[model samples]
Target: MPSCLTCIARKVKCDAPDSLSDCGNCRRLGEECRRHNPVPMVVSRQESKQFTRAGTKRRRSQISCLDCRKHKRKCNGELPCARCIRMKRECEYDTSHGKEGTFHHSYSVQAPVLSSIQTSPSQTSHTSSSAAGYQSGSVNSPYFQSDTSTQDLDPLAMFAKQCPLFPEKELMKSLVQQFFARIAPCRLFGFLHEPTFMMKIDQGYGGRFDEFLLLAAICAAATKVNHEANKQMWESGVEWARYVLQQLILDLNRISVTKLMTLVVLHEHEYRIGNQSSCFLITGLCTRYTHILQLNVEYDNDILCQNSSLTASEKESRRRLMWCCYVMDSFASSGVTHLQLIQENKIEIQLPMSDEHFLFERAIVTDLTPDTIDHRAYLVRLMSIRNRILNYVKRFDKDRDLWDPQSEYHSLLSSLQEWCNIIPENWNLNHTTIYARKSQGLLSPLIELWIFFHLCYLDLYRVVVPGLSPAMRPEIDAVQIAAPTDFLQSSQEACFNHAVKLTRLLEASIQHEKDGPLDDPNIIIGAHEAIRALVSYAKVASSRINDDTKQLLAELVDISVHHLRLTQKRIPTAILGLRRTVSIIKNSGLAYLNYTNLESDSDSDSSQERPGLEEQLNPLSQFSVAARGLSERHGKGTSSARVGSECSSSQKSMFDDDNLLSPGRDMFPTSLEGWLTSNQFGDFI
Candidate 1:
């Protein structure tokens, strides 16, 4: 039953009983008594067949386009398929199957066939048998056979065979857990999202070669934090991981984020092992890969829409990886422009989010480097500032004046102060704050962050303090101000204060090592720089400062040296650098009191024999004994006469060379400046 259109339009109820019947009101008015009867949809035979085929599922084409087949995408069975045209790839179909009367396409035998495709009964039976074999993990299955043929060729497989740890799933899992727990929290290694990475590990790395490589690298890094009992086992695993990663570098035909992550970890591992040259080369490789991948720029929303495979977490990881590369570049370049591969102006990617957001895979938008105070983002920002400082310091010869208010030096100094002002109060290094951060597993990163901040001040202010920075000594000497100006005095005072602060911070960090050892190699460099600044100031200010001030400076140097000795056990480069610094202090005739012995002696009231002040002030007279000791240890000639002759000649020509820090020279230099500007110190940095 339905209402007529005329009656309904007139706002009256219809009396029609069916859709085809006329209404009573229209019939009485002698108007057309029409009802709203929807006409039946008619179809031609061809159109009916098309409709039937659409509902039942039309058969797939007997062939696929070449481009579609290569990329494993769907084809529309047209001359040029939609995928091919959209991807801008050439499209061509194989017509040879048409002549065989049995249509066929070249596909992997493991690929499932569409149910609508027509196949011979024998083919159907063979496919069923193959499916059963595949399900059972039989070697006879084509997919399994193909995997077997290339199993030995895979680098990860070779690595697994070589790595004893990889075969022990439990041990491997322990090391992986150790890495994420200890090492991955550092800002440089924060690119990895633990939940996603752990999920992949629980699924056996999802059969990905890159994931396996990253896992191997993780195991190697974790070994750095391992105990001494397993040192040999850890070393073997590290060596195999390094070798396999080196080999994999040669086979990289495409760029991937996982591969970049592996290289980043391996770069840090290289630095930890004292291979600065390898670290430099690897950083360059990573920078090139980063550029090729365009990780420096955020993906356009349109591009992100087209690539459905990129998840929100993956996008965040890309941004983090980009920042990691920037950090590595900053360290490797160390302010040398020719070595700088990634420029800040070129970086358009957003800074990393907070660890909470990143680890939980939240897709929140974050501020850029200058705005964000998130731990990871702020670390990158500080790194950018440090890079600018280094570049300005390195190019001191070109700068007009360090004291000018409008100069680059003042600009960099202002930036450093601004950075310090923005630091949250909780970041302060005290016993209570240290313990609080330790409870949250953030003690190491907090210490490292402040260490880096102090290092920037050391590099900047040391340029004006004569004998402190070897690189700037000649340039500063050329200016030759007779009496120190207010600016120069302020710079010297700033340099000395920061050096003392750096030493104290390091001492505090070492005393509070209940959580773990400081893993960052840069900590060692910071300690060395602090010691250098303190010793240099002691030498120049010996006549001006009182005995108590001299003793205080000596204690600071001892504290820094103690830290170096402790770090030497973990980092090989630290051992050599520490020895050199010790030799320099002894030869320079600066007070080399042992801080721990001083404490014990004060309690026992036992007097320790100390070198006389006259001998300490005479730097040239004290060089022979220290030089001979170093020479004898290195298997060089131990004759005091030869050592004296070399010391005399070194003092005469120490400032003659332009590139004082050049490599491949004497392992033990005679003068304090020689030791400060030696290749050993340069390579350690």
Candidate 2:
């Protein structure tokens, strides 16, 4: 059974004696093939690199340059290797150098100058040359730029002429600058008669070659003179403008935020101990996303409806972009943890990466730490995790329509269940045995929690709501994690509750600022909606428990309550008086409301006014409806309504039959929470 690999691989006869260094065919062929070590049929997938090391090193392709990726050839990966040097090409590394990647342009110096006064971008301050001019480590920013002034940025003028997206550079600059207006103003009170920055972003640079970064720099650098009265960032749409660069970010593989996150991970040492500014930038970006998305979701009646102002294709593109950013934030922050671990270490660090960190994380830790072990195991784990993620992504791509909860997203939750069953709980984070405690943090948990919540809400509760019927329900398999109290044990209940609470708090604090006060109505509203939904969800979720789930449920209750009171909501504060009322309603089946004040003010006509009697008023109310599930369990239509707003005359309230947020019959089965449970078939689906 003895064999020679070289001859077998070559399809030649293994004529040599089976010795470490005496293969006869190799000897005849003048090739050194003395060994025939058995290779494992399956690689661990973690030690992929080690497997390569066992074999001969891969030869560098004779070609060397970034473009080599597309050309069919081996890459020497050289600095202008023979091919590139011969062809007069610049050797480019594919590292994606983070946010700094976008601005780098390789201009052929001989291109003709435009025969007119050249125009500079409104965002001229962010020019690549200026970044290039900055001495490394001189400016604290991870991004380097030229010290050149805006007026000298003639490249933009030429950029317009040379690039397809930039015809009429002057007009483009003016438009981009004006677009900043909707985003720059102070306080947003929910409604704006003015066009928003998102409108411009959705419209203006659809395919424009980024002639605007230059003007953005100019605007960012200039005083807030006419820029809408120097509004505080969190005050209004300005945060949107500040992070407008992220418009480029919403893509699946957004190179910009990924790069910025890359820079943060790579240069963690510079900002780690206390990189307040970078921290501020990140906080703003996340806050903006939170507020922007909250607004987008809540605007059922406002002009602020989602990218609807854009064409159908644009709307879909923007939606995907936003979701991608949300998803990537999970991995990117996990990448940041590599940096955090450095300061946590008691010993001196000397590596570019925590051998445990991401490839992006490796960019930071390894730079700081000295080389040691091959870190083959960590690499394997990362690759395996990535592969599984790719599989999930593939599933999503295949069923794009069902990816959202309103559609059959719950069917996708089963995929997550498979993931839960398979996701690794252990990891090789460090070389040392003492400090290498096995754990995966932050990333996996966030992905798990949101997907789980969406499943529970979308699938199980869709059909049961009493008042509104969805016109159509996407076909999706149901999960058994219902709110009926019969599906789970009391002991394990806390696990589910804790998961939901953590997701809510995380969303609330996504853009939390350390120095700034938190008072924006939109931010407040976002936190309120998330918290209230989760809180209501927890209340109903408790129905699904057995005695076994008691402790877990109790612990979850503690955590959820602790966080609930920590937020700044006067409504919650004032309603704290209703604690007993709420507890009674939840347990004893009574809608809690103090109507004594109304009784005292009965003399007032408005105070005495009650819900108007329709042509037919159900004599039966909350209890009657609860027993039956609903007056009518089936839906009337694919009903969706904007919460907390005035409905237009033509449009009927999905829950107009009852006040769903309230516990009255009006708030019965059709209440959002009730709908989620009844229609979706419950049990975390």
Please write out the lDDT profile of model 1 over residues 533-612, one tens digit for every residue.
Answer: 77777676566678787778878887878887777665555664565456546545664444332211121111012221
Model 1 lowest lDDT segment of ten: 132-141
Residue-level lDDT tens digits of model 2 in 1-685: 3556666656667766545555776666555563545454435422342233324223434323456666755565433334443453333433343665433222111112211111223222333212211111100111112222322344544333433233254444444443233221211100111132234334332211222332332233222222223333112222222332332233213222222222222112111112223333453354244333341232122222233333222222222223222322322222222111111122122211222232111222122122421222222223233323322321332443432444433444454454344333332111332123212212222222333333333222323221111111122112223323332233123333434554443333332322111211112222222333333434545465445444443344333343333332311221221232223224322122212321111111221122221101111111111222223433332232222123343234434433334454343335667656664422332
Give the clashing residue pairs of candidate 1, or none: none
Per-residue error for 270 in candidate 1, Å, reads: 1.0
Q: Candidate 1: deviation at residue 346, Å?
A: 0.2
lDDT of 2 at 344: 15
lDDT of 2: 0.30
- TM-score of predicted structure 2: 0.27
